[model samples]
Target: MSDPVSEAGTIPVNDSTPILAYGPLVLDVPGRPVPLAMKVSAPATGTGLPIILLSHGHGMTTFLSSLRGYGPLADFFAAHGFVVVQPTHLDSTALGLRESDHPEAPTFWKSRPAEISFIIDHLDDIEAAVPGLAGRLDTTRVAAVGHSLGGHTVALLRGMQTRDPADGSTVRVPDERIKAAVIIATPGEADEQTNQDMLNNYPVNKYNDFSTMGMDALVVAGDKDLNPMFSDRLSYRWDAYTRAPGPKTLLMVHGAEHIFGGISGYDASETTDEDPERVSTLRALIWAYLRSQLYPDDPAWNRALAAMGDFGTVEAK
Candidate 1:
C-alpha cells in the first residue's frame, strides 16, 4: 500500500529515506496494573527529529486499537522526518483485561491522557530501548495526533474539560509540552441534540467542556459523518474545532465518514467510506497541516489545500 501523498512535492519532506520501526517496548509505569506497551517509528537517518505521539482509537478490533495498529499513519510520518510513538491505552480491547469496578471502567478516559504524559516524561528510556534512536529526538518539538476516542484523549491534553463522575468535580487535563495537535472524529458535547442513549452508554460525553480547549490544533471532521447513535447534528463530530478557541484550523473532508476513509488501518473492514484516494488525500492534508504548524515558514499546507480543490474545505483562525 503506497501512499500517493508522500511523493516529492506533496509533503514537505526533503528526505526520501526508509523508516526504522521498533516496537512493543514495554515501559514499567509505577502503579499501572499493566506496563505501557508502545512502538517507535523514525526515519532511518535524521537528527533533531520532531516527535508525534500517535494515539489509537477505542475500537472493537483486537489490534486496530492496540500498539500494533495505525501502521498507515505511523509509517507515513516516520518516513517524513517525525518520530511516531503509539501507546496502547487501557481502554484498548486488545488488552483483554476488564476493571468494571473502576469509575472510568470501559473507556479509562482519565488514564489515557496520563499515559501520554507518562510517555513524554520517559522519552529518554524509550530512546535507549531502541537500537540506534538514542540522542536523535528533540523533546522541544512535539505534536499529538489522535483518532476517535484517542481524539478525546488528545482533546483533554489540549485543555478540554471533563467532569469526574465520582464527585461531579470539573477536570481539566492539559499538557503544555504539546505544541500542536490534530483531533479526528471525536465525540461532541452532550447537549440538547445529544441522544439520551448515547449519554446512557457513555456518560463521560456529558462532561466534555470544549470551552477551555485553548490550544493550537487542527480538527479533522467528515461532512457525511452523521452519527445518529450519538447525536442528530452533523457538526457534532467537529465540535472540538468549532467550540474551542482559535489559533485553530478545521479541515472538513467531503463525503467522508467516521473513519475518514479507513485511517484506522489499511483496508480496514470497519471503514464504511473505504476509498483509497480519499485516504491518500486525507494523509496529504494532515501531513501538510502538521508541517505548516510545526514549521511556520512551510508552505506545504497551502500547496495541499490547492491540490484538494474540491475534495475538502479548510478554515483557520
Candidate 2:
C-alpha cells in the first residue's frame, strides 16, 4: 500500500512544489524511558514559513492518536507553506498503557500542551532534523491546531482552564507562545450549559473554562455531529466559540460528525459525514485562516470571511 499520508496530495500549487517530511523523531528528555516522538513536514522550498503544532485526539486505536493520523490536514498545510509538527502523547493505545486512574483521566489532555510547548522550545533541533529546512521556519508565527480531545489541548495553549476535582481549585496550563489556534470539534465549558451526559463522560469537562482564551482562534463545529458518547446537545460543541474570549471565529459544518470527514485517517470508517467537498472546503478555510493570520497581506483571509457561508455559517467576535 502507498503511504497514506503521502498519497493524500497537498494543496494546489501551480509551480508543482513538493512537501518535505521527516518522521519518528524521537525527542528524548532525561530519565524518560521512551522520549516524545513526532513527524515534521514542510514545503520543499520556503523561507520564514509559519509553524503549526498539531495535537492528535484520542481514539480507540493507536494510529489515530499517534503520529499516523490527520494526513489530510498535515499534507495540505505543509504543501501550502507551513511547518507542521505532530507528537504522539503517552495516552496512545499503541503504548499499551492506561491512565493512572489515580484521580482523573486527562492522561493525554495534561501532557498534550506540554508537547506543543516542547516542540516550540526545540524548534532549532526540529529544523536541523529536516534536511534543508533549517532557517526556513518563522517561529514568531506559530499556531496550535487539534481535533476532538486534541482540540481541547489546543484550547489550553490559547489559555482555556480546568478545575482540579480534588480540591475544586482551578488548574491552568496556558502557553502564551502559541499565537493562533484552530479547534475542531472541541468540547465546551460544562457548568450550567452542560448536559448530564457530557458531565459524566469526563468530570474535567464540567470544570472547563474558556474566559482566558482571548487569542485569535477558529472554532469548527459540525451541525449534526451529535456525539452520543460525549454529549446529548449538538450545541455543546459551540461552547468554545461562545465562551472563549475573542477575537474568535466559528465554522459549523452543515452535517459533519466528530471525525470531520475522515480527517483523523485517510479512509477511516468513523467518518459518518464523509463528503469530500465539505472536507475540501474545511481544508481550504483553515489554510486561508492560517495564511491570513500569519501574513497580514494575504487576501485569502478576507475572501474566507466573505465566502464562509458556502460551506457553513461563520460567527466571529
Candidate 3:
C-alpha cells in the first residue's frame, strides 16, 4: 500500500485499482427467521488480503441500511486491497420486518454481532460464492466497521456489555476473531441528558457498558452529531472512545454530522453533510487505521495524521 501524501492529507483513494464485487450470497442459518444475505467486494488481484466486515446502520432509507448500501465504502476499501463483506441485518427496512415480529426486532442488537461472527465463520463459503476470491483472503486478519446502530454491533464484538432486561443477566458478546474495529457515530452511556422517551423505547441502550471494550479500536465521532432523540449532549457519540479502556483512538471530525458526509452510500438522501471531500478524507483515515491495526509496521496511520490538516483531530490512548 502506498503512503498518503503529507501535502494533501489524503491516501490513494482514486479508483485506480479494479475490483470484483458479488452480492446477495445467501446463507441460511438454522434458527434464523430469514436467510442471511451479504455482498463481497475485493480487489481484482491481491493475495493474503485482509478482511473487513462492514455492518450497516439503521437509516431512514429503505435500502441504505441493508447490504445494498455503503457502496462508497465497500468500493473504496475493495479497490484499496481489502476484502469487504457486508451483511444485511434483520433490522433493515428492506426486509419489511417489524419490532413486533421478534423480541429484538428494532435493532436486533444481539443478532447483529452474531451476524458478523457468522460471516467470519463462513468465510470459506463466502470465498466459494464469489469468483476469484478463493485463496485470496487472510482470514486471521479480520476487522469490523459499523455505523450508527451498526457501530453498536462492532462495540459488542469488541467486548462492550449491556444487560438483558428480560432475564437480568449481563449480555457480553465478544468475538475474539475480530482483531480490530472502527465504531462510528454510535450512542453513548445514557444519562440525565438522555431522552427518556428514547430510552423507554429501546431500554437496552440504558445498559451500554463500554468499560470492557479493551480491544484495539478507532472511534470516529462528529462534533456536530447531536441527536435530541438520544441525548442533548454533543459528546453523546464519543462514549465508545472516552468510556472504553486504552489502546483506542478517537477521530473527532469537526462540524461533521451523523452520516459523516454520505458514508452509507453515494448520493444518499439521508446524508445531511454531503461533502464528497469529507467522505474521501474519512475513508482514507479509516483505511489508514485498519491498515495500521493489521500491519503494525505500516506508516499509513502516521502519514494520515501528519496530513490530517483541517480534516479532523486524532488522539490515541
Candidate 4:
C-alpha cells in the first residue's frame, strides 16, 4: 500500500523503510470529529501481523513526535513484526473542552472508551483506503496502551462498569475488539479534596465485572509519582479483584514520575533526567507484555517475557 504522509509532510512513508506514517484522518464520532495521527510499521517481509492500537496520554499531539521523544518503544514493537497504530485525541483534550458547554467537562476522562471505539471504527476505513494493511491487521489480537488519563480510559475500557449518578442508568462502551489492555499511571477513585474531583465524585459501578470482557490487563505505575497515592489505589483495586478471566500484572517503576518517563520527548529536561534507567526499563517491560499477549506461540516473545523481570522492579499480585 502507498504510505500516506502526515500533515507535517516531514516523515516519509516507504514500504522498504522501517516505519510508515499515515493520517491526519478525520474520525467522526457521535457529536465530534477528531483529527488523528497514525504511524504504521512492519517487518521487511510485510506479512499479516498482530495489530496494537496505541493511544497517547493527554496533551500529546502527534504519534511520530511521541516516537521521537520516547526511546524506541514503538520501534521495538515494529522490529518484532507488529504494526503499531498511535491515534491522537487532540479534539477531545481537556484543554479543548469548553467550560460553559461542558460544565463538568473534566469528568469526560471517563469518556475515553467512547473515543477509543470511534478510533477503532475509523481504522477499518484506513485499512481499506491504504494498501498492504487491508487483511494484514489481526483485530482479534488487539490491545490498547494508554498513559495517564489515557490509562484511566484503559481501565474503563477493560469493562469496569459505571453508572450515571443522577439518573442511575448504565453506560455502555462501543468497541469490543480490545482483547487486552495496559494502563500506565492511572488514577483511582479520587479523594475528597479537589474542586473538580471527578474520581471522587464519579460513579464507578464495580471492578469485579471485567471477566466478561475477557481481556488480559497490565497496570504499571511509578513509585515516586507526585500522585503516587492515586496510582497505588488503582493498582490495588486491580490486584484485589478476583473476577477478571485473563491474567493481570501490576508493576511499579522505581524513581519514575507521573508523566511516565517524561512524555516521549524532552528527555534532557531536569524532570526526565531523574530516572533514565527506569524509563528504559518501562519500555522494555511494555515490549515484553505485547509479545506474550499478542504473539503467544512465538518462542522469541516467550524468551523476552521471561527475561523481563530481570530488567526492572516487578511485582505481580
Ten-residue segment with the worst summed lDDT in candidate 1?
5-14
Candidate 2 per-residue lDDT over residues 1-317, each given as its tens digit: 74333221233322325898888988886443358999898889979989998888877766878887888888877877788998887777676554555343545466667778888999989888878888898889998899888898898888888876667887777787777789998887665545676566566787788988777799999888886556667787878898887899998877788887778877776677776656666877887887777777878767765766645778799
The model with the greatest TM-score is 3
Query: Which stretches in model 3 have alpha-carbon errors above 4 Å?
Result: 1-9, 12-15
In order of appearance, the predictions have TM-scores of 0.94, 0.89, 0.95, 0.71
Off by over 4 Å in 2: 1-16, 30-33, 99-106, 191-201, 307-309
Candidate 4, residue 223: how far the Cα is off, in Å: 1.7
Better of 1 and 3 by TM-score: 3
On residues 1-317, what C-alpha lDDT tens digit does candidate 3 reach at each position? 96542211365433448988898899998788899999899999979999999999988789999989999888888988899999999989998775555878777787899999999999998987898888988999999999999999999999999987667789988999998799999989899999999888778899999999888799999998998999999988999999999889999998899999889998999999887778888888899889889989988888888877888898999
Q: How accurate locally, in lDDT, is each candidate? A: 0.86, 0.77, 0.88, 0.53
Cα RMSD (angstroms) for every candidate in the order listed: 2.3, 3.7, 3.5, 7.8
Q: Clashing residue pairs in candidate 2, if any?
A: none
lDDT of 1 by residue, 1-317 (tens): 97554342333344557999898899988877789999999999989999999999988888999888887778878888899999998888888754456667688888899999999999989988998999999988889999989999999999999998768888898999998899999999888889998788778899898989988889999999998988999999999988998878999989999988778888899989987677766776777788888888989888777767678788988
| By lDDT: ranked, best first | 3, 1, 2, 4
